[model samples]
Target: MRILMATAAVTALTLAACSPAANDQKSGEPAPPNPTQTVAAPAEKPVYRFKIGALDAIALFDGQNPVPNDNKVFGVGLTPQAVAAPLTAAGQPADPIMLEIHPLLVRNGDRTMLFDAGLGAGKGQLMQSLQTAGVDPANITDVMISHGHPDHVGGLVADGAPAFPNAAIRMSEAEWASIRANPEMADLVRVITPKVQAFRPDEEVAPGVEAQDTAGHTPGHVAYLITDGQNQLLYTGDLMHHWVLSVEHPDWTVGYDDDATAGKKARLDEITALRASGAHIYAYHFPFPGLGKIQTREGRATFISEAQPAA
Candidate 1:
C-alpha cells in the first residue's frame, strides 16, 4: 500500500473509521501528536552498500512517510499500550509511526536488477536516490517486483510509461493474474504488461534470485531470495511493516493485510525460518536501508538493524 499524505481531518477520519465505537470515549484524552509535522533531517546519501557473497547489493532510500499510528492500523486485537511498548523500548516515537521506503539494487556480474520500484514520480525520492547511487534506469537489466502494491510497483512507470524500458519486469504469475483482474490495478497492469515476465512460485527469476511464495499480505504476494554462493538475503516485501510490532508480536495483524489470518501465519513462519537460517533480511517498510537479521531471544523474534557506517 502507498503511504498517504497526513492531514488533521484525514487522520481523524482514519482513526474514526478503523476504531470501534467504544474507543470514542478516549476522544476526551488529548489527541496524540502528529509525527509527520516534525520533519526529519535529510539523509546525506541515499545509498547503503553491503555485499552478499560476491554480489553487490545497494539499498536506495526513497523517502520516509508517515501513517496513522492507531491500533486499528497495526494491533487490531491489542491495546495501544501493547503496540507502543516495543516502540518505546526501542527509543522510537509511539505515535504517528514513520515508515521508510527503500528499494534494493542487486548487481551480479553483468546483470543489474532492481528489487522493487518505489512510490512513483512526485510522490517519492526513488529517482533522486537512484542518481545518488549512480544507477541509470536505462542500464537496469531486470526489474523484479516483490508484490503489486503501489509503493512496490509505482516506480515501474514514469510519465505514463515504463521507466526501465529495456528491462524485464518480473512478477509472480499469480500476482500478474490478480493485478489484471483487479479494476483498481488495471491501469498499472497495462503500463507494465509489455515487459512483464510472470513466473511460478519458487522459480528462479534470475541467475541467483528465487521467488519465495509468501502470500497473505496480498493474494499472490511473494518475497525474493538472492543467493550468492552460500550467502543469501531475503527481500521481505510487506510480510511485516513495523520492526517492533511486527517482529515481537507476529500474531497481531495489520489493517493493510488482505487476509489477516494468513498474514499472521506467514509472518510467524517466515521469521522462524529466517532466524534458523541466519540469513540477513532487508525489510521494505522497516527503517531506511532496512538491513538486519532476525534473531530469537527467549522465544521472541526481534529485528536488529545492522550498525551504520561512521561518517
Candidate 2:
C-alpha cells in the first residue's frame, strides 16, 4: 500500500511538470513570456493597461484556467450550450471555457492599492505581469480584496505566511463573516484575521477608494470605486465570472456563487448601475485585467472591451 501511494504521487508530480501552463521563466526574471495564445489583445502591453486621471491602473495577468467540462458555471437553469454559443460567435472557445484572472493594481499618488492579489508564486503568473509593468510586490501599500475566493486570496499566504508583509490587507467585514463561519476554511480564516482590517460597506477604504457592497457572489463581495478628481474606475469583483455569459446574460449565476439567485440579481444591478454611470468596469474574472464597459441594448447587457470601444 505504501509503495502504491508513493508511485501515484510521483506520477502526479510528473504530470504537473508537463502541463501546458508550466513555467517557462528563466532564473530571476519576470514571468514566463506573454502567452501568444491570447483570444484578444488589450489596447496596450502588460495585459490591460490604463491611466485613470493621475491614478495608474494596470491589470496584472494571473494566467488562465480551464473551466471543467461539466462545471455548472452558468447556474442550474442554463445549459452549457446557452453559455458557449455566444462566446463561439464572438471568437471564443465553444467548450472548455478559459478564464483569465487579472489582479488589478492601482497607483494613486503615494498610495499603491492592489485590487486582488494574484495567484502568488505557484498557481498563476501575476508576479510576472507585475514585474513587466515595473511594479514590486513589496511596495504595495494596500491589498484590497473583492472577496475571499482562492484565486483572489490565494496570494495572501504563500509558503504559509503573508505574501505582502508590508501592506495592510483589507476585506469586507461581512466577507470575513462567511469565510470564518465555514469549518473547512476556519483555520485559514483564523490565520488571516490578525492581519486583516475589516471595513464596513459603502465606506472609504483608502483615499479616493470607496467600497460598494456588491454581494451575492459571496456574502460580503464588494467592489471598489476609484475616482481621481475627474476620471473614475470601478473594479467589479466576481459578480460576473465570464465576459460573454455574465454580461450577455446577467441573470446567470456562477458555479461558485454562494446564493445563485442573489448573485444573479447583484450582477444585473451592478452592471446596470455601472452602465448608467458610464464608468469603466475593471472586472476580476471577465478577461485579463478585465477592463471593459457594459452596454445595454433591448434590455440585454454586453461587454465592450476598453481596447475596442463601441462606435
Candidate 3:
C-alpha cells in the first residue's frame, strides 16, 4: 500500500509540472504582466474665470470640508434618509457631505475686489489661485465680506497682522457688531479693526456692487449684487450651501445656521426672486466655479451649472 501511494504522488507531481500556471488560463495567450508601479499626481488647482455682466469675475476655489451626514447636522426635524434623498437622486454621495468654499475676484476697470477671504493663511488655495489669475494680494483694493465667519475673515490676518495690507475690508454694520460680541473672534477683530469699513445693509461697497441683507445664516449674512448696466450677478454667501438641498428644500434647517427659521425664509425668498428674475448666481458652497442659474419647476428649484468657457 505504501509503494502504491508513493507511485500515485509521483505521477500527480509530474502531471502538475507539465500543466499551466494559475495565471495562464488561456490556451495560447501569454500570461498577463504584473501591474506597473504608480505614483499619484498632485491635485489640480480649480480656478474658473467668467464674466458677471461686464465685470470680469474669477472664482477662486478655497477647498471643501466634509460634514457628517446626520439629521443633526442638516435637517433638524427630518431623518437622515430624507435629507439624503435629493442628493442621492442627483447622483451624489449621501454621507459625509462635501461643502465647497469659493471666493470671488471681481475686476472692473482698474479696481479689484475679493468677495471673501476663504480659509486663511495655510488652510486654503486663495493665494495660489490669485497668483494663477495674475492677481497680487497687495494689489487687491477691496475685500468685501458677506459675513464675519471664520472662513470669511480668517484670511484677513496672518501672523497677527493684516494679510492684505493694501485692501480695505468691508462688511455690514450688523456683521461687525456681531463679530465684536463674539469673544471667540476677538483676535481676528483686533487685527482687522483698523481696516474694517462697516457699511449699511444696502450700501454699495464698490462700483456696480451693492450689499443685500440676507440674514439668518448669521445675523448679518449678506449677499452682493454686481451689475454693469446691461448684466448682473448675485453672490449668495451662505444663504444656501448644497444647491439641491438648499434651493429645492429651503425649509430644511442646516446645523450651521444661527437662526434656522430665519435662514429658511431668507433662502426661500432669495431663491424665488433669483429664479423669477433669471439672474446668474455665484454660490460660495455649491460646486467649484459655482456660476449657475436657478430654475423652478413644479415648485422645486434646480441648479443648472453653467458650462465652463473653452480653453
Candidate 4:
C-alpha cells in the first residue's frame, strides 16, 4: 500500500565516538542538497535554519564522522551480508559507514536552547557552526542532553570548564548517574556535575519541552518532544543512528545499545509513534541537519528528509 506523502550508523567506534559540513550559501532556499551527493556548498559554512511552529530552529553542521561497518557494530546478530545489503541498496559503500555530526538548536521564547552538544572543542567544527548560526556560547540558556555519550556531550566542556557558561545543562537523572560512576568520564563529570539539572523521565523540563524516555541505547537515553502551541518536533537523541540500518530496519540490533533487546523495542515503538502522529523530527544522526518525517512506503518505514528534491 503506497500512501503517497512527501517528507526522511552506528558503526564500529560509533557510540564511543561522532561533523556535518559544506561551505554553504544559504540553505532552505532551493531544495536541500542530497544527503548522498556532495554538491557545491553555498557561502554559509553549513548552518541551516527552519521554523518549528513558532520557534526558530537551526542545524549546526559540526563536520563527517564515519564509523566502520565491517566491525560487529551494526547488524549484531546477523551476517555481514545482511548488514551490507541495505548500504548496497542505498548505493553506499558498506564499510567505513558515513554519518554526520550536527547538534540541533532551537529558540523557546526568549531562551536559546541547544540539543546534544557536539564533539568537544578542537575535535569538531561545532564552534564554527555556532558562529555561522550567529549564536554566542554565553547566551545559550539551556543545553538539553539526549544521553551522555562523548559525541553528544563533548562540547559541554572545554579546558576543564563549562563551555556554555550561561546554559543550564539538563539530562535524565539516570544518565547523570550512569556517567558519574564511570571512571573514564571522571574529568567530564568533574566539570559538568554541578551544572547538570537531572530531571525525571517524561518530565517537562522547560516550557514546551518534554523528555520522552527511549532508554536502551544508554541507561538514560531519551528523545525530546517540543511544541510551540501550533506545532511540535521530536529531537531524537541517539534513538536511531543510521537511517537505513536503524530507522528503516528498526528490528536490527545495534552494537551501541547498552541493552540491545530494549533498544530494538524502543526504536520500533518510536517509529510507529512518529508515523501515527506525523510530527517533524530533528534527527541526531540520520543525515546532515537531520530534519524529516517518517513515512512507511511499500511496507518499509523510511526517514524522508524535509524539502529533499525528487530522488
Model 4: per-residue Cα lDDT over 1-311, one tens digit each? 00001111212212111112211213443322122322113124467777888889888877566777754678887877888887776555567666667898899878899998989888878888888778999999999999988899999998889999989999998999999988999999999888889999897888889999999999999899989887889999888888667877888888889999999999989988887776788887765667777765445665656533212
* Ordered list by lDDT, greatest first: 1, 3, 4, 2
Q: Per-residue lDDT for 209-293 in model 3, tens only?
A: 9999999999999999998988888999998888668877887888888988888899989888877876888889876666766
Runs in model 4 with CA error above 4 Å?
Answer: 1-44, 307-311
Q: How many backbone clashes does candidate 2 have?
A: 0
Encode model 2's per-residue lDDT on 1-311: one tens digit a residue: 11221233223333322333332224454321111122233323445567888778877777666775354765456677767676665556656776677888888888888888867677877777777888888898899999988889888876777777778889999998888888877656756777789999898889999999988889999998899988888888888777777777777657788888888899888877866765778878765556756755334465655542212
User: Which consecutive 10 residues in model 4 have the weakest lDDT in total?
Assistant: 1-10
- Model number with the top lDDT: 1
In candidate 1, what are the lDDT values of residues 1-311, reduced to their tens digit? 22232234223333432233422224355432221111112266677888989898888878776766677778887788887877776556677776888899999989999999999898888888889889899999999898888899989999989999899999888888888888998778888888999999887879899999999988889999999988988999999887777887888878888889888899989988877875788899886567767655444576655524324
Local distance difference test scores for all models: 0.77, 0.70, 0.76, 0.75
Superpose all Cα atoms of candidate 3 onto the true structure and report the RMSD in Å to 1 decimal. 16.7
For every candidate, C-alpha RMSD to the true structure in Å? 10.6, 12.4, 16.7, 9.0
- The TM-scores, one per candidate, come to 0.84, 0.80, 0.84, 0.84
